[model samples]
Target: MFEEKRSILEPAGALSLAGAEAYCKYYGLKGANVVAVTSGANMNFDRLRLVTELADVGRRKEAVLATYLPESPGGFNRFCELMGGRSYVKDELLCRFVFPERPGALMKFLDALSPLWNISLFHYRAQGETGANVLVGIQVVDTEMDEFRDRANSLGYVYEVETRNEAFQLLMR
Candidate 1:
């Protein structure tokens, strides 16, 4: 009986009330323990809804922002203030770069981050075609936010953050 129930739950097998009962009986589990049960066509009908519900949970996914900024006076401080003002930012990841046209640009950016903030993670430089842009990606734990935009405004960097929900929806579609 246990074997029969296990077989019913198998992806290739048909699911039915009788099959589910056999499975429960074999496992010595009660019907209340079963969150859902389906057989054949019913399974197909339910699958998408289940997937949609699970996808909804992804909305709580951490937010990550990537920024491109130039090395300049007070630029870093303004960035920090923007992030600091937000109560939801969990951590910052810094990536620095100097355009091939300019030397020592990376060092200056790192120095900027040093005075008031701790870099949770850092990466530097792209392999080729050094542009004036430096990309930084930061993970935010909370969702209620807009301070990052203000921070970007202060720092003069174009920034974008993707919340988990947005990412999930994009992926689902």
Candidate 2:
């Protein structure tokens, strides 16, 4: 099980291939798995591409809070509804707040969240008045996000959706 997990994390390359070859030579390994071998330079280029293109894959695997959204009931609900039924939402992360520095501000913000939605897994507040930016990170499970943009637009939040492929290319290039 551990070997399988590690294999998933391993990059395609000569070292891994060589190791497999050595293991087969010594231990008489037998399997129908196909193997491809390439030079280090080619591997490096491909690896860079994979790293750049799949960076978002890591983000999708783990949720990081984004500092975007206003402190309003309608805003909160719209955000949640936009994220409704996401496949990756095992928890919510709340980091940084740009709301007014007054009593009941935090309460009002919390109240805005629907009970149907899970409590944030992470939370924090901005340091100064000038930094009125609320950062929220939510887990995303579903890769198919056809309605996400529409929902966010309906709620009046400007959002940028970066697919894993595009994110990787942007990062790699």
lDDT of 2 by residue, 1-173 (tens): 11334322224443566576777778876884646553344444446546434544544853557768888768876886687623343533223335555567556555544222444333344333443345444333355234433333443322343333455336322
Which 10 consecutive residues of model 1 have the lowest summed lDDT? 6-15
Report the C-alpha lDDT of model 1 over 6-60, residue by residue, as the tens digit.
3222232323554666778898887455534553433453554443343345445
TM-score of 1: 0.26
Stretches of candidate 2 exceeding 4 Å from the true structure: 1-97, 138-173
Q: Return the TM-score for each candidate structure.
A: 0.26, 0.26
